[model samples]
Target: MEPKNQTSVSEFLLLGLTDDPAQQPLVFSLFLTMYLVTVLGNLFIVLAVSSDSHLHTPMYFFLCNLSLNDICLSTCTVPKMLVNIQTQDQSITYTGCISQVFSVLVFAYLENYLLAVMGYDRYVAICHPLKYTVIMKPHFCILLALVSLLLSTVVALMHSLMLLRLSFCTHLEIPHFFCELAQVLELACSDTLLDNVLVYVAMFILGGVPLSGIIFSYVHIVFSVLRMTSSKGIYKAFSTCGSHLSVVSLFYGTGMGVYISSAVTDSPRTTAVASVMYSVVPPMLNPFIYSLRNRDMKGAVRRLITAITSFL
Candidate 1:
């Protein structure tokens, strides 16, 4: 009596956020609105960055990539959930679930790395303003982005490939809206010691390293700003870092909250709700944080809107 291979399990049922029949339409509408807002908001950020010549700096370069990553990350899970809700069908094929898992990991890690890279960019700007241009050349910025993408892809592929080794049981209902890697792993009938070990290792390398880098960058930035004697210089320094700090706080704060909540609670539904705070809310809020807090970004977005309307 051996467990079935992953291929043999044709599909898994996603229980989504709620099971109440009366709430289906409301759920569908809410997620659809969020998904649309996420896509359009991030898309506008990308377009503004690319269209404005004033935004051709290393910081904007990284911001553009981040906007793209956020769009991909939201697309990875939300659309499938929306489809399931609209169709009243919660089944996701084996291939689709695995693909979702891989895609989610890739974009999530990319976002993490980009945030760290942006932090370093800020540190260099604030700590060594004279060498900012030389330190962050266009080619160097491109290299950092490519390296982040490569590492994110490699790490995600490793996890997804390792998941292929596990054998699953007949009970294939996932209590989450999407095929979260941890939820999927919990359903496996085979011993998941190796899988769990790899997960922990990846968490440390991918998650902890970037977080540490961000903290390190900010430490120097804070010290550099403190050395400035003029009140205007202090205000200018904080203003430059304000949008980035707000975004970083939203991303990591929600993520850490989700992690802690999941660890404390055994309820899958509770965990799923917490996951939305990190996954859905941050992406939706990032564009607003940047555009509203950043004068340059606001001007660029306004110009972009004007150009589009004039052409129409």
Candidate 2:
């Protein structure tokens, strides 16, 4: 085999969501709105948590991080997509594509681990109420956050490095709006057996482990709630969990849909659309789900709005 230079492909053509010129305007408008809303909504969560000292608990700390992750996740993809739509250009530079893949992977995995951490927070609060403060202390919470960020960064770095080793052909076109890891791997000319193996190992360790933690945490929570003698206690416990559970369901459900769609259909477009649900929709809706279902969050947001209004 001839030694191909890494610079063989300087750019990749992104096919985007749809090729219809007529629908371009509508698609652009729709995504622009979603992008703005996602940013603003998650921003509010972060601000509300920061402004309100009453919300300075471990739970809200995690929520703030989750919101930040959502903003980053959306930023990693949407701005580029919006730009492509407006300019009627789908080409992404090789460097830009690599950056996108790295950024998205970091945030995506961070969110995954964060969700599990939040579930653990809930479990400690509900199941071990007396020890909640002791177990989820400020320093401890910070440690958890740091660990999540570090692990995610390491894994994302691994994937990006692996992709860098592979070579691409001249006609480098990606069917998705962004440079999804799977799609990029599929386009590679070099042997992808190692990449596939690494991806599966990552799926099992990174994906399976955190998901198991969330499930275990929730199961303990449910049992604790069921054992409660007081109806009010049960209601309060369930209420606290409702938002997190909803966010969890949305994240994993959409993620599973993307995987299933990709496996079931050979259509990259369909998989791309499904990927939107996990990558785009969940982040956009997380703020709403958390704030609406969480009394402390709503109160904090109201206080935040009132303070801003008074200042203005």
Candidate 3:
């Protein structure tokens, strides 16, 4: 049932990451820099992967998709936050908030699944090297990407549709920079038992399943590496997955940290502050992690830079 007393509410006030007037400019500048770095870094990864023929394999193909996901994920939240901070307007219209939620959900879930797919790609490349080409063929890679996008779309749509059914009350101040699903749900006026249940189920299916897959893939990869006769082969195999493993640790760790922080703390502001670690940090760092650790990526980036400079 809709709340009759608060039926006229049209906008939700986002409290944002901070409320200190003195800190606003600093925050804006800091986030703007992070956002730019995140965008340019991921863009470079995408461009490098696309331009370099040597990176046309399944691993780099998935890396390109992951970079694309990182771009969208950061874009969905950072731009809005930056706009709000720069304008000093925390009010987000209902439609805008819903759109933000949907976009963020889609990209976030897609990234999660894409990381798992990358793990599986590595698994195939390492465990069954002979069949890697057959298993991760171009068509198959496309199919995996399609499946990730489709699943994420469906899940985001489900959350968005469910959100549409709920009526918000007069108290619509969200204590976060963006319309995160959990924060938005907390502001709902109606009974959210079903929404809560759905979120849990979806989290288990989306988050748990993918994390399990990544772990399983890594476990097999480790076993395979252990079986290698040459020490150099083990080192090479580990080096190849090092960047991915770091990302997975950072991504899942920050997410779990946010969840745990929210659960253990009673402060919405604290949770919001912690959320930045997951939302902003991972995307900003992923490019550096991949590029710095990878010789092939370094060469591709150099080539990309050289070509761009020559063209200019």
Candidate 4:
């Protein structure tokens, strides 16, 4: 049997979280609820930041982008899964799968860069308070966001183009909800040595560098906080960073868990289930983490709600 080029392969079967007929309804309801929460929660964050003049700063600006990215990330995977479950059709067209891979990568990488940028914003505001406005100007903030988006697009394009080169075997069933790049590569019949190498290289450069930046920023922040003589100053510093740190922990912790679980376990299904932690849970929880923990965000949201209600 001749290996077919990716173009010739019309579709791939996605073996979602479970195959149980009885469990489909439960899965559908669970993900539908989660998807709604994730979208609405992130949407509220964006609205709160944009509508409130008080939150028109670097931190909230980065946070607004992060919320948008989270919405995109979840949209890339969950709706398709929901549709698949509801229709009892696991088949995804080749173009659809590739688009999913690219979209997921773009948004996921954007989130990584945005989080690191947010950490740097906090660090500047805390450790170099007088220089915060000068260093993180409005133009610079916009530039940072554009750069993150450009880098994410280029990286995702590279991976997607590489995927286009590979030939796939007949057995094209992916044991996951969405079209994950790694899993798609595994299905390729052609040599994926170069593809695999590129994946790790991109991961290290994209993933490691942002993580390192976040750690470095927070380390400086911690030192600055410790140096504060006033308890009030110390409390203020911690309060400012608490929500971001919690969000970072949730994002990175779940991401690392997915990677570790995938590496340790041989079951693709297990990996799929683990992926929900990073791909679904964090997005749903992030808005709550920020709004509940940060006083400024709470105030902004409250004002936003009041305005909306009064207008209504």
Error of model 4, residue 152, in angstroms: 0.6
lDDT of 3 by residue, 1-312 (tens): 554535456888999877799999999999999999999999999999999899999999999999889989999888888888888889999989999999999998998999999999989989999998888999999999999999999999999989988877877889999999999998887888888998999999887999999999999999999899998888889889999999999999999999999999999999999999998999999999999988899999999999999999
The lDDT per prediction is 0.92, 0.93, 0.91, 0.94
Per-residue lDDT of candidate 4, residues 88-132 (tens digit): 999999999999999999999998999999999999999999999
TM-score for each model? 0.97, 0.97, 0.97, 0.97
What are the per-residue Cα lDDT tens digits for candidate 2 across 74-116?
9999999999989989999999999899999999999999999
Best by lDDT: 4
Tens-digit lDDT track for model 1 on 121-179? 99999999999999999999999999999999999999999888878898899999999
True-structure RMSD, every candidate:
1.6, 2.0, 1.9, 1.4
| Model 3, CA-based lDDT | 0.91
As a TM-score, model 2 comes out at 0.97
Model 1 stretches with alpha carbons more than 4 Å out:
1-7
lDDT head-to-head 1 vs 4, winner: 4
TM-score of 3: 0.97
